[model samples]
Target: MKIKRRAMLESTGLNMTPMIDVVFQLIVFLMLATDFTNTEIERVYLPKADAAQADDHPDKTRLMANIIHRISTESDCPQLKYKNGVLLQPCQIENHWKIVVRGEEIKTQERLEELLTIEGNLDREVPGNPKTPSNKPVMIRADGSAPFHLITRVLEAAGKALVWKLEIGAEKPPE
Candidate 1:
């Protein structure tokens, strides 16, 4: 007796569920990762420089210190009222100036120094070594109209924290 053999062909399709899930996960991860840089940065008019270098590559562990200059809304100056159909300049008090770090406003220099010290100590030459200098980099982003004294104070704080690596934010002049 002879047995007959038959060939069976079935169509197979690729399951796209895993691929879609992976794509969604990657999108979420990128959104969360990029948010850190955006939140730390503040809206400040940077000084224009002829020799400003573009930051093609940025450090991930760099700390950002933003100095914002704010004009006082409640000023005692009578010039705030329109005179001769022209509005005068509002009072820009030094007390209105504030330093922001990591989306938190730093009211006092001592607190700012303490924050910087803690961040600096996160990455030291010797692990958990307080005596060694910090390997962390810091960037100062100050408004063009901001007072120089404020920048000086930030410098002092950074120096005290032993964070030697520093970068000043500047914008290139429009051609």
Candidate 2:
């Protein structure tokens, strides 16, 4: 007896619509998350610390003030490091530096203090108590070659604002 040949199976393609949607969703989520976190930080070359501790648990409500030196002219001896694609150089001139907070450049010390004061006024630990300082933490991220006086000015501003919780940013020395 002659056996009948089996019918050939039809090839099916993958339903990629759902997969593509999922991938796009993930991309959007990651972009949003990255923007929120990075908006608060400014890239600056930090000083090397012998005993620097990693910020494993960063507070979400923490405030950051970044001291950036606007590199004007090429230096004879550059810092030889790059942070956020900007070349780090030794800038001793006070005018070449500026303070940035929450993506806004603080042009004057008065303006810096004013902004910090507003920040300090919110979320008081002891409600309705004027003496109670703000619970929010503030951090100063200064470039390695930044002038000490500028950092001091930031400290004075924080003190004036009554935000006591403060931190200085530093990086571990290269091994």
Candidate 3:
């Protein structure tokens, strides 16, 4: 008698449930890991420029200054001053628009004239072509809370100092 044999079939279906779950988990993880925060100055409104470019190159040898306007503890009026990166006591707070360089506080007309003369003398000492401007530019990282008047004053001072360029904005780290 002939023996009857049966053909065996194999299952070819693949389960995608685990893979889909993992992909969703990865998406959620990435979305939660990224954070966007702005470090704008407090209480001061910054003027917005519609035509401003997002990616501008920062000057390499730039001089930085911070302008702070606060109410004086002794007086009720607002006071302006130039502070270094850190708010140290050496800061000059007498006038909001004046800045000191090389141990001299430049504020009045006479002082400014003296300052310019001193700067000219120093520039003469450097061994280089007098016609060429300084390689270093002036970078003004004024607080958004700072007044426009103060910022303009800083720009004017930098110009008088023969700074190659003037840049004003908040500080950002390089990518």
Maximum-lDDT candidate: 2
Instruction: Report the number of the highest-TM-score candidate.
Output: 2
Give the whole-model CA lDDT for all candidates, comma-separated. Answer: 0.78, 0.79, 0.47
| Model 3, runs deviating above 4 Å | 1-62, 74-131, 171-175
Error of 3 at 110 (Å): 6.9
> Relative to the unseen true structure, what is the C-alpha lDDT of residue 79 in candidate 1, on a scale of 0 to 100?
26
- In model 1, where do residues sit more than 4 Å from their true spots? 1-37, 71-92
lDDT string for model 1 (1-175, tens) is 6554442344367889999999999999988877554678898877777797897777876789998754457645442233443334532566767788988888888998998899899988887986688889899998776678888988999899888888889888779
Which regions in candidate 2 have their CA more than 4 angstroms from the true location? 1-36, 71-89, 129-131
Alpha-carbon shift of residue 164 in model 2 (angstroms): 0.9
| Model 2 Cα shift for residue 43 (angstroms) | 1.4
**How do the residues 93-173 of candidate 3 rate in per-residue lDDT, one tens digit apiece?**
435433333334445545543454344334443545444454454445455544466666665655565554555554442
Pairs of colliding residues, candidate 3 = none
**Which pairs of residues clash in candidate 2, taking residues 3 or more apart in a chain or in different chains?**
none
How far residue 102's Cα lies from its native spot in candidate 3, in Å, is 9.4
Worst 10 residues of 3 by lDDT: 37-46
**What are the per-residue Cα lDDT tens digits for candidate 2 across 1-175?**
6555553454467989999999999999988777556577777778878788887788877788999876557763244445564545566666778898998988888999998887787757776654578777888999887889888989999888788888899888768
What is the alpha-carbon lDDT for the whole of candidate 2? Answer: 0.79
